[model samples]
Target: MRQYLSADKEKELIETANTLMAKGKGLLAADESTASMLKRFQSIGIENNEENRRLYRQLLLTGSKDLANYISGVIFFHETFYQCDNNGKPFREILKDNGIIPGIKVDKGLVPLAGTNGENTTQGLDNLSERCAQYYRDGARFAKWRMCSSMSSTSYNFICCSNLSERCAQYYRDGARFAKWRCALKIGDGLPSELCIRETSNVLARYASICQQVLRKFSFFSGFRTD
Candidate 1:
C-alpha cells in the first residue's frame, strides 16, 4: 500500500522547495551532456573535454559565495558528479559543504519521436523510478529531465505529455520532489520564428496544464499537495 503523507510532511516538502528557490534565486545548471557542451563550446571556440568541462564548472562552483547563495543547487552530469576540484574535494562534497544541494541529470540523450519527421523526446525512463529511488538514497535531493519538443502546422497538434509527465510526477511522489519542464522552439528554413514561439508556448502551456491536472488528482487521493 502507498504511504499517504501527513499534513506536516506535505507542508515540510513544500517549504523545502520554496526554501530552495528563496531570496529571488534559482538553480544553477551545470548538467550538460557531451554533445550539448560541445555545441556550447563551439560558440565559445573552446574544445569540449573533461578538463574543459571541469574548469567551466569549477568557475561556477567557486564563484563568489553571493552567486552560490542565489544558486540553491547544482545539477551535474554523471562525469562531473564524481570529479574533484583542485583542492581535491569531490564535487558533491564541495557543494554540500557550501549548503548547496547536488542533483543529477538522469535522462538519456534525446531520441527522435516516432512518426515525427525530425522531432525528439528524452529517454531514460526505462528504470527511472527505481533509479530515482537509488539516487535519493545516494544523497540526491533532486533530479532533472530536460525535455525538447517543437510544434508546427504540419505537426502542430501532434503533441503528447502524458507519459513524460507521469514519469516525472511519479519521481516527485517517490523521492525527487522538484521538477522542471523545458521546451524548445526553433524557427528557420521558411518557418517564421513567431510561429515557432507560439507553438512552443502552446505546447508548454498544455504540458503544465496536464501536470496540474495530475497533481490535483494526486492530491485528492493522497490527501496533500506539493504545489
Candidate 2:
C-alpha cells in the first residue's frame, strides 16, 4: 500500500508539479557539480574559477526576466543555491521574482555498488529529511536526486532502481515534492542489446510508478551516448 500525505501537502505538491509542467514551459537543470562545470568551461576555453562560475550562472538566471515565459523552474547545485547576481540578490530570489520556482539537487552523488562490476548508486540518504526541510525553508519548493542505472556486462540490474524508488517514497514524506532519476544508455553498433533496453526501461518505469504512488512528481533524464 502507498503511504499517505495530508490533503494540504498533496495539494501543494500537485500545484508545484502542474506549474512546473505548465503549457510550453520547461525546467532548467543548472545543477552541475563543480567538476562537471569545470569540464564544461574547459570546452569553451573559459576559466573555471568561482567568480567565473558565479558570473556565468548569474547571466543565465538574471540575464532577462523573460526567462519565466518558458522556464517554470530551475534546478540548482548547492553552490549555485547560495550564489548572487551583480546586485547582491540571491539566485533563488531572482528566479522567484520572475515567477520561476527554485529547486535544489540533494544527492551526494553516485558510488559503486558493491558486488557489482562497476555498477553505481546515488548516495546522500543520510540526513535527507533534515536537508529537505531546510531546503524547503530556503525557498526550494522541490528537490532533485539522481539515481542512475547503467548498461554494462555483468552490471545491468533492476535491484538498484527498485531500491531508489522505495527511497523516493521516504523523500516525499520528508518534504520533497519532486524527484529525478537518470538512466544512462550508450548507443553503438551491437551495443545496448535487447536485454539492456528491456531491463533499463522496466527499471525506469518502476521508479516512476513508485514515485506516483507516493504523490511525488518524477522526472526521467536519460543520457544517450554514441561511441
Candidate 3:
C-alpha cells in the first residue's frame, strides 16, 4: 500500500534529491565495513580499531569547508554514523556543519542465494522500520541497501527508503530525503540469462516498491552494465 506524501514531505524530498544531484557535486562513499577497513589498513601497517576509524573519519570530514562544494553528501557505515571525532563532535554534526548531508548503510551484509553457485543476496530486512526511524532520529537523512544480482558475474548495492505514517513517513518528517539501489547486467556469451535478468529486476522492483510505500515519497533509479 503506497502512502501519500504530505505537502512538506514532498517538498523535502524534492529539495534533498535536488541537492544530491547538484552539478559538480556528488556523494562521498565512506561507508566501509570494519572488515573492509581492516584490509585497507593492513596494507599501510595501521591498526584497525575504533579510535583509528574515528580519527580517519575526522580527517575526511573536518577538512576544508569547501569540501561541501564538491561533496553533496556522505554515506556512513553503521558504526561511523554513531561515532564521534577527537573533539567530541558527532560525525553527523560535523557533516551538517560542513554542509554535507548524512546518509547510512542499512543492509546487514550478503548471504548465499539458494540454488546458485557462489551467488548472493543482501539481508537485514528484519526490524527495518525501527532501525530507519532510529537512524532518522539520530540525524540520518538517507539510506543504502547492498543488493546483488543472483548471477555469478555481478552483484548490486541498493539504497532506498523504508513504514506506517508513524513508520515510513517518519523518515520524510524526520529527514528521509533520498534512497538508492543499483543492479547491473553483464555482456558475454550466455551472459544475462533471461531468468537472472528477470530475477534482478523483480527484486529491485519489489524493494523499490517497498521503499516508496513505506516512505511515502517518489524515487526512481536504474543500473545496467556491459562487459
Estimate, for each residue in 4-92, the C-alpha lDDT of model 2 and write its tens digit. 45567656655766777689988799989999998999999999999999999999888886899999878899889989988899999
Q: Write the per-residue lDDT of candidate 3 for residues 89-186, one digit (tens) a residue.
A: 78898888877888887778877666544455667766566677677788887776655544334433322321111112112311346665444443
* Highest-scoring model, TM-score: 3
Model 2 residue 213 lDDT score: 47
- Candidate 1, residues 1-227, lDDT tens digits: the string is 55455566556556656645677666787878888899999998999999988888887787577765678767777788778788887777777787777777777767766544455666676565566566666556656666665545453432343233223322232124455445543434433344444544554444333433322211221222344
Sort the predicted structures by lDDT, highest score first. Answer: 3, 2, 1
lDDT of the structure predicted as candidate 2: 0.64
Give the 10-residue window scoring lowest on summed lDDT in candidate 2.
218-227
Score each candidate by Cα lDDT. Answer: 0.58, 0.64, 0.65
Cα deviation at 109, candidate 3, in Å, is 1.9
Higher-TM-score candidate of 1 and 3: 3
Q: For model 1, state the Cα shift of residue 111 in Å.
A: 1.3
